[model samples]
Target chain A: MQRRIVLDLDLCCGCRSCEAACKAAFKGEARIRHGDIAGAAYLPLACKHCKQPLCLASCPVEAITKDEKTGLVIRSAMVCIGCKSCAFACPFGVIDAPLVRHISQKCSLCADREGGPRCVAACSSGALQWLSDDEIKRHEIGMRMVSKDLFFRRKA
Target chain B: MKNINPKAITIKKALCPFCSYGCEFGVIYDDFGIKGVEYAKDGSSGGRLCPRGSAAAMYLNHPRRLAVPMKDGKPVAWAKMKKDLTKVFGSPKSTAVTFDRNVTPEEYAAIIGFCEKVGIENIASTYFEPESHLEPFLDESFDVSNLQKTQLVVILGDPFNQTPMVSQAIIDWKLKDRKNGLIVIDSLHTHTAGFADQFLRVNVGTEPLLLFALAQKNFEGIDATKVTGIDRAIIKDVSRRIKDSKNSIVFACLSFGHTYDPALCAEGISELEGYGRMKIVPLVEFAGYEGNKGFGSIMEMAKKKKIKYLVNFGELFPFYYPQVAPDLKNLEMYATSTLKHSGYTMVPVPLTLEKEGTVYTSFGKKKLLGGIEPPSGARSIEEIIGPLSGGSGKGKQLSVPDHKLDIKERARRISEATLVKGKGLRLMGEKIAFNFLGFFEEASLKMNPADAMELNIASNDIVKVTSKQGVEHMTVRLTEDVSQGVVTVPAETPGARKLFEYDIDTDLRSVNFIPTEVKICREE
Candidate 1:
């Protein structure tokens, strides 16, 4: 029952449209808070939903927890302060400073929405996707067999 | 200075007429005209600019803007201007006319009919790609993100500081690591050169001579001392330096000075060229040189099969020929360009900044520019071509095939597809992003403290930078920070280089040409 975000590395043209769209969805209500140039390169990461949850341990107030049914890490922003201990505790730099708000934040598995992560929805190259853990494993096996070298050899 | 009056300035939202950087600026003005300029924080440039943008007001406020069209030698009113335009070919036939700068959208439509009636074969709208249409074909892969994997980067004649986004990229590249070190080869010391790990200073015009010298050492001959300024010891040092690098890149802008022997330059670097590990990126001043080459070559292939009249709307022809300034004929040509000139003819573009248009080419699509609407009765190059080739009634319809997709969206798709396939890297595959390309186009790169030298030229000294056309002269700026042999002048000025003499006899050369011959002399 575990869920995952599928990535098609080859299909990713690296437009960063998803990054902009995601920033806009949360922050565009007032104004774009991030003063950094709009198109600058970014690594938009999400949690792997590890078996040993770091968020659960790092949260002193117990504001962060994992959903056993879907394996999605959930965060209660209402109880959280702006202290960034959770951001530091997460091994994968998935936590982003939310726009113009005084609270720690990370992807809550797009909990309010019906679809998957908004980043996947806005990706122009179809490089991002949400899938069940079983589906991800099957796809990974096929991808590994089709191209032995996705990250190492080819340089363009 | 204390007596000068200050004027209230207005921040105009107009896009920069330079390259795709699209920087915006505030124009300080009064009854006296445009006074000065500052970067527009809210505009495309995001409040930062190169020297050119900082000084745009000078060029635009220059006294010599063409207030009226000059037919032959007489300045006429708008009424007569249109009549003359109509008389040029009688009725709308098949003829194309390129404009200098600034034409309204409506006027653009009118000119199309003029070209069609005049029987213009093919109209090349320079307005569509001011610095030559290199934008539309750009993919997200060309964005700065690709620099993560970039190893060895090379910049030729272009100095990134002279341009905008490219300079920012250079600063970013430095933040990443010296792991992605830089190599710059040029006649003069450029801002791009200052940032390089290795700098190759070649004699002017003899850029080819230096390249040939390198090739000779690698293969045919070894007498490097006789061929170039660099001695055998230096060549060996340079050769070893290049050989040691795995992902080496060699690039040149060929704008400021000359690298006449690009083929030789390519061959010299060819020693380091490969499909993946090593590559050459050309830094071009004009936009769309590569894309235009692709389309033009294709059209040529079709021409061989008896195809006639290519209705080029969103395309530009590659200026394959080396950059050369227009020859100042019997009538003394005067211009103010980035390269100041002196002597026989007057250089104008360099002396003052003009309200120029911007050029954009992203994902292989080209957009010339937008500015204060051209004065009534004026025409744009696109308008001239549309009517000539049977364009839509008002020239409002884009020449793109009927699909209704936005040009920007289409261009993005094209860029994405090409990048995903990664096949188009064929012109020596080491993926050259926009910043890297900017590094190559502006050959005079950043220079280091030790490597840098103050040019002999001094401030206000009338010096001429020449090409085949003529020589242009301007007030010289002598800063020790500028690397020697590298002349740093603002390109924003259109004809600033017309003050210099060509040969002390007839003035018929300009500094606009690549590899221009320059001679500095004190005013008598």
Candidate 2:
């Protein structure tokens, strides 16, 4: 029932349009981060929204909580003490306190928006997708087959 | 701090002033000021904007924005600044004005009228290459809408960085028509190349040669692999695919040095006329180029005679014309009206978002800047230049010069000529990142992974790049996108300008296409 954001690494061109769209949708904060891996692969990293939610557990003040309906990990600025505990606990490094604002910030998956995240809408290459758990599994299978084909072709 | 209520927000339609495309966007403003920007549904961009367009509001109220007029690095009153300007323009014959391409039509007309009245003949706009490239293509009656119907599309350079909307349109068309072929010919593996069905990484300044070879349908005796750094078979295959397509269009950006030979490429593309329909679309990437007609006429007159006093409006003098900076300093008087202080007789001016005027889009359509007020005290070009014109000068009618048609001979000569191999690395300028002002920043030397390894250089290491013009140290970035023997720096950086060879020819005045050879060494 919960939605997850999946990225197809092969489709991304490192344009960072999703990052820009996220910043525009939010108030000057981009939840999604784009970078290159040793000049070979383009990576667009965002909140994975793990079932355990390490960031939510690590918050001493209980400022980070998981949404009951969408299962998204949300951070509250009102209760946050700017201790950066959630940022240090999160394994993915998606949560961080912006220099201007002391509160820790991360992607909310555009929970309030009608459709989904703005990053998904802004992706021109069809690399980013918001889908249910079952849909993500099926999409991952298809992507794996394509990657395998490309890998074998390169090897040949 | 004033809390911005969502209910009190007002959406105003405005044009993106960054590039020449002039795509429309809706500015979300409150009583405090601009809050954010959104894509307009009925805009030229079709409800999509580049990263810069999405963050347009930040640039409008930048912390460093020029709010008041300054003289000798100190703020001055409007009356005193006007008196200083009058003193400079008192000698009309010796005074000249040059403006950035972002001027509105009415403001441009006012500047032209002022120049005519003052008999100032040394005025020129920042963007002059588009005048030569776009004029000839537009005269041929090339329609951009035809891109959707084309079966094959060829991009010369990175239009995605310059004109994202145009690039998106071509990509969307390709996605819809699965059989359509897309070819990207560039020195680096640009973002546009990611969507390309075939990407040919050619050597710098060798675009004309490859295009000529394709037109001749001959690759005899020459090692195509060595000259173009592309396989001969791939070239033959792409050429065959181009010839076989029904409708083919070549989208060429005028920002690159290789694109200076647009006439040659146009002629080469025309060779496919018998097989199929072919057209060339000259892409103008910068804003306000359409209003540069008045500025172009002044540049022509200045070359014919010497001028002493000069005024610059919204134009970055040394950034665009580095060679003329020394000459400008030697003048009797020099004044600049700009958003950022460049240390001339400074007169602060408002940006496009703060003014109401008409601007010509890259597509040659008229668009209005819809804001009601100029930023508290800042004045528009018309408000400043109008009073100085004395109201006696009528606007001058400008004409675009005809493009020379003797490109076939040059193409043949190029095809017969040998590829010149330079020692060490070939340095090129590329657009890297868009900052708050919609201009490129983070200038670094992007080297190929192989070249980086050979030089014992790692990513993010500082390196010294030396050209005949000068030497500058820049951080090194390793990437597989660039070819092995080439190093690329951000086109907007000072290091890139050092590679430029100054030529007063109107065609090459604004664009640098000469292949600059540089030596790169690790800085210890």
Candidate 3:
């Protein structure tokens, strides 16, 4: 029952709605996680919900854990201390530093809201999508057989 | 959130008044005043907002903004303000006036009318007409779509990346399926040069030499070790790229006013033609400003005639064309402006919603007098243009518009009629967006080009920039990236204007300091 965020490159118009929405959902203002050029591409990224979570293993305080019900990686805010371990451990630099509060924060898929991740909802281009593990795997397998470049491989 | 009315958050499509890139922005108004602003969806800025546009809300609410109209340096009511303005301009006297073009068209017309009534219509001057074209950018025939076909692009004065939209377009073109090469010939390593395939750091003001040498395929003194301070092999490599390209496009970002050497562009035009189909594009800064270049063309025509009364707005004819302003001392002057030096100065624009009523329209118009709710204070350009165009029957005579009123079209009509007869060639129209204005404002560094990495100059540290006409003290800003022998200051600042040598003398005080190779030193 693991959930992974799926990307539809075709729908991704290179508009930065997800980036802005992600910042607003987690933090009050839209803060770019990295330099502009890095985020220029029309690629939306989220925790892959890998069979082995790199963040959970990397957390020294055991602050990060995969939810038993959803198999989604979750961070324990109360127990967590701001350390660079989880950030270094995760290959993808999804780890973000909240501008207001000096603490580590990441996309929680807007767990507090009933409607799901705010980024997914606010994306006017429908570039980012929520998907179950099976669907993500199926799409990846289908996409892999074709050109690996998701943006250019779309069939006419 | 104490029973906040949904109507309180009213979003009005307010035009950004900073630059010629008249970006329509959505100003969010609450019952209290302006809350925030966002880029209007329909305007040239699209949904993207730049730092200037984003910070506009702060500018609107800044405490230092001019809240009340002023007459003789003191606050006065709108009626008294208009009366004082009328009295000063009532006589036909030659006066120098500097005015901003952002005044509503209605105010523009009213000011023009005021000038005519007072017989001061002949010497009205504003910022350079060509520079102001950067605002209210119009869709031009010479567009990016035309640029895509180009294989070569050259930038002269202003760096491109500092102006992002244009830079982004050029970048996209360079990174296209079949990459197009870019050549940046500038004095410093500008951000625009970063994306260029090759950078030619030529000596400042020596663009003419570079162009001539390139045209003749002569490498006499252009050796990398000598001219550009680069490896000899690198020069050969870049020259090879230029020579090998089939379709070459040359771009110069420096204003024709500052650069003054049109022959270099002519040489570039000729060289590009030799290769294949080459086009030379002048990147003008103002909105509907292409019309101002027509004035330059007109002044050339006027030299042969015995005509009088050259009225300019958002333009300074003498500074733009030295051949004109000096000979026209008998030329009557009239204009309304926010600056202190203008022959007719009105209230300064204070930044805020509360003090907004204090700022009058460009024509010294008070808010809609005795009207309910007063139309929210900000006047539209169209409102000002109508009255000045003689709709009110109080202003000078103007040619009637045959078609629906458009600023670009009206400007063209006026330029055509005003041009000393028989010389009117249409120049290409230009399109600039609001966000690009933000980029220009944000990207241009205020540091002096000569000094680097030092800041502790005397509090009012003025640097002397000596040309033949004498020396002027410009405020100094120190940064590393600025090159020696070049001084970069904000073009709009008062200190910078003082540095601008506006004189008729060819050998001394000529505005063409580029050719003079004047040295700048920190003033004691």
lDDT of each: 0.40, 0.64, 0.43
Candidate 2 local lDDT, residue A28: 64
Candidate 3 lDDT over residue span B1-524, tens digit each: 67767575667665444433334456667778766554455755453343344545555654433445444456556565445444443334423223344443344445556555544523322344222222221233455566676677766544332233244356556555345666777655554554455667664434444553454344332332443344556656655666776556665455422432333333444554464344555454333211212232233334544333343444233333333444454444332222233232334432222122222221122332211111233222223333433443234323212222232232222223222222211111111221222222221223442333343344235755655334556555444334543445444322233333332212111122122334455667
Strongest candidate by DockQ: 2
lDDT of 1 by residue, B1-524 (tens): 44545444444444444434445555555445554443354654444444334334533543343334443445545455444344534432322233223333344455454444455533333322112222222342344444555666766655353343455455455434536666666655544555566666654444444554444333233234543456678767665655676655554454422332233344344444532244444343334322112222222333353222222222111111112122112122211122212222111121111224334332232333334433343334443334434553443312312222232332223223222422111100011121222111221222223322233434455644443444555455444334333344433223422221122101111112232334444354
Q: Which ten residues in a row have the lowest lDDT in candidate 1 chain A?
A: A28-37
Residue range with the least summed lDDT across 10 consecutive positions in model 3 chain B = B423-432
What DockQ does each candidate score versus the true complex, computed on alpha carbons? 0.01, 0.28, 0.05
- Candidate order by DockQ, decreasing, is 2, 3, 1
Number of colliding residue pairs in each model? 139, 5, 38
**How well is each residue in B1-524 modelled by candidate 2, as lDDT tens digits?**
77767668777888877666667878877777777665565876655666667767666766656678876678888888788788777777666666665566666667777777766655556553332444445423445667777789988777765555565567557655557778888777777776676778777655655765555444455554666667778877877887787678877764433333544554554554333455767666543432333443444445555566667766454445554454355454344444545455666676665567666555675557666344676776666766765553446533334435555455444434326555778776665333323332346778988988888999899888887667888889777777778787665454465564433434323333444578888999
lDDT of 3 at B461: 57
Give the alpha carbon lDDT tens digit for every residue of A42-90 in model 1: 2345566777788678888888888788777777878777677777887
> Comparing to the true complex, what docking class would candidate 3 get?
incorrect
Q: Which stretches of candidate 1 lie over 4 Å from their true place?
A: A1-156, B1-12, B24-44, B55-63, B72-74, B90-118, B122-140, B206-251, B261-283, B288-359, B362-373, B376-496, B499-521
